[model samples]
Target: MAQGDMRDRPRHAGAGDRQMTALDPRAMRLANAETVLRALYGADALSQAAIATATGLSRRTVELILVDLEAEGWVRVRSTEPHASGRGRPARQYAFRSEVGVVLGIDIAHDRSTVAAADLRGRTLHTAVVPMPGEPERAERLAGTRRAVAEALRAVGVRPGQVGSVSVATPGNVNDKGAVDVELSMHGWTGVRLAEEFAPDFAVPVHVENNAKLAVLAELWEGATPGADHLLWLMLEGQYNGMGIVMDGVPYRGVDGAAGEIFWAKGLGLDALTASPLIGLGRLEPEERRAEATAILERAERGDPAALSEVDSFADVLARGLSALSWVFAPRYVVLGGWLAWALGDLLATRVAARMARNAPPFVAVRRSTLGPDAVVRGAIRAALDRYEWTAARPLAPERRPSPVDGG
Candidate 1:
């Protein structure tokens, strides 16, 4: 837990062209709902005719879909005068509702777990963290995560049932069963069923994602590099080293959701560095280990000979590993994150960038994470928030409005 850090489609169908009557009711309903949603999403507000033009549906059909969306609390209907004027009655416009409910974000890490309760629009209502036990089992970790979630909700005076969705970010890989396949070498963490841990208790959908990947999500959503299609997120906490890939603004989870497990790049993360003779760095006490990295970085910053030596050694290894990865993926931007990024700071970034510059042509930029330690958890929150967006963006059933009467 670093600390709280700073901020920052559709087919067209004509009304009387015979396509409407030939279309299936279910699909037409879904398509109309989508058109209405697109009209609202694409604009601040859209009248039925505006939506009709954008969707190629009749104004009455747009009205029917608007009724359904409003009924489901997905849109807010407002009566306003048409821009063209000459209307005896105000025309109705629709706007997407942003505050339908809240989503839960949980970050379960090697040291601690945090839970954040936020509105659908990604506004944080409350958040809390619980320290993980020195030795935790499947049940204990789940219990701890649940406690944090409960506390977060309670802090905000919300109920479990009110949560629309949940996303969990952890140090391990998410397996098919929704359990995180934590590296066996990790301390106090192993076979943990992240989905079962929360799913049984909460009716909302539960999503388990790698912390680094989640951090990448956070960055892609809001960070220094926004909307970069090709990105590489490197998570280098002393305990773990991995990469998260975002292809075209979407996470590239492999067939088994292990695409970011780049730690195996030339056996760098096959096992803890303790197993490697070159590094010769063994796992110290959690506090000592964390402090040691910070101290080494501090000394390096001051140009200490020994600290500089160690930093150079680590940088060599990282450069080699990153170079190998870059040769393959060739990401546009590589964002350094996790505790190691915080400890090493710009020194590490510059070092890595210099090494990567050797690759030539299509140089991948190296930058420090703006979200800091909260990146992964915030990304989890983002995952939860995405559910709301997806659900709302989807098509829904709508009533078929009566045909308009033509005045000859």
Candidate 2:
């Protein structure tokens, strides 16, 4: 193992671990295997001697666990150059077999459905996007999302059985049961159990989360907001405006998962703020709205006064919202994400930051997202990977075995 990997390799036994070790010998073996497996997963590769030293286990114990994990397809021996010593060969190094299974991350927005397939290491293998019909029925929207997931999995050449977990990021308030509690974007989306909808197809654990919250998670996972334990994500997607709150490095899904639903209230002036040509183009046909919005943004970029005025007005609305949320959350950073961020770029973010300077804390900075439009899906992948990591402590059941259509 590298020096960097060895820095935090020691495992501290907690009360649960102390209790577990008091169990039968079989339980002891399981515990030892889990410890070795966790150490291997955290590093690029570890020789048996390195694993033994890092895990505080006997060399023989580490070797036995490695053999078992390898047989179970959860570990792989890495290929290394021969040692410089003329006396013997180099010690064998083992790596976590992250490519052994796949995971799915689906993002279902009102206008489009995107699905990304990733490995256990959270590398996106393939992605598929399908445009939704305007004002689509609930069933139609769900079917489209399902088709997108299927296409993504097929492109990755992995079957549903090969997936360890599936996570969905949707535009709504999601409850603990993975059901939409409040449907903000699409009609008839409330009360829909997304986990149940996809469970039969995937035959694995399915999780659902609000897209805004997931966007915030993506920012922490892959976005530019590094080391920001307290952060806010202002979502400005089509026909939807919301806030995602994160405090102490965890998404704060308030009571009933409605923490950041301030926009829907009439008192906030957010609805009227959407009337500007740069923000709200609801009067135009759905097909024309996006194009017109793009043109208006282009005009603003070219320094058109009218377009700039509209952008400024839109920024005012965002600034007010950010100012209010900042007072409450006092976040270290605020990220502008969703379609609006992608379209407006830093121009809008800078304006919002300038407008909020008087009201918000000086330390609370605002910036545009670098994760692009797929942030929600990428966050879903992170969520699924988090869920997958928990399963590592247990043995893989026979039914959960992955059989790839081509290869991982």
Candidate 3:
């Protein structure tokens, strides 16, 4: 990764502050090591001095951490490339081990699901998409998800035991207890214990989160707003109008994990508009509504006035929903994602921004996601990868330990 790529990481609010939490002596050392590893992962390759500078650790401390990391096969020395400064000997470079283990990300959408495998460096190695059956039974749908994720992982040469961790992003509110509570608007999904269901089947640590939250994670990790401190993500799709907020590089899961479900706001009355013929109809089995919407977009792109009018109406509904959210959170940057992001393009961002600006503070910036359709899955993979690092550091955590049947 180049320095430019590092810029994509979320900016730390206070560089000099002791950002790492205080723990017992041993845990603190492990935490410091983890921080050093994260710096190496973010930089792709960094010199000892660079790591020390970036992490606010002394050169000796960074060197010791790197030594332990290398011994543990978590990091590797890449090269001794000389700098152009031409004042001293070439400096050694280090990076996270690219092939140490594999992480899987599963994005479960209403109509389809995506699975991707990536390394710690966030490089996507493979991806697969499967059509989601319109089954109303929650068990049946979850079974299908299991099979889809299994098949995708197998195709990418990832065995169940080899998967370091897995993250699943769904269209619901996930509470701290790992219970999914929000209504999924989709065919099947409500009150699901995603972690419990998937954990036994995959035999790996499972982390479940709302899809919009994962999208924000993807943006903060490697997308357009990598270094943004406060971000609001809006995912406009046929089935659900999802939103997520990130503050100081961490997701702000509001009380009951519904921080950004602004579409349900009473006064805005957006639930009715979101469920209107212009949006909700697209979720039908035949997908004819989607075809119609696509046709309208195509005509609008060709400068057809009638199609443009319909598109404008759709954009207006989206803007209205966003306006409500802006009034509540007032995030620094808002990112647009999901299927509509690809279908609507700049028009979506432009119209949403215009509406939000009417109600937002002057400093807010709105932009479309550069991560495209892979945003959720990539975010899942990133989440899984982070869990892997944490697990390696502290395998005794209840969440990290394997089930009894798996020989924990």
If scored against the real structure, what TM-score would every candidate get? 0.77, 0.86, 0.79
lDDT of 2 by residue, 1-408 (tens): 122332223243457865877876666776787688678867888899889998899999988888888887778888864666755887788998766777788998877898888766677778788898668888999889889888877776666766777889997888888899888568889889988888888667798998888878777776888546899888776457777888997889988788887667666667765676655333223656667777888888999998888889888887886787788789999888877777788889899999888889888998888988778888898777767633343334445433333332
lDDT string, candidate 1, 13-126, tens digits: 346523664666765686567557655655667778878897688878888888888887778877686556675777777776545566788988766779887754566767
* RMSD in Å for all candidates: 9.2, 4.2, 6.4
Evaluation by TM-score, superior candidate among 1 and 3: 3
Q: How far is candidate 3 from the true structure (C-alpha RMSD, Å)?
A: 6.4
In the predicted model 1, the residue pairs found to clash are none
Q: Identify the leading candidate in terms of lDDT.
A: 2
lDDT per model, in order? 0.68, 0.77, 0.71
TM-score of 2: 0.86
Q: For model 3, what is the C-alpha lDDT against the true structure?
A: 0.71
The count of backbone overlaps in candidate 2 is: 0
Best by TM-score: 2
How should the candidates be ordered by TM-score, best one leading?
A: 2, 3, 1
Clashes of 1: 0
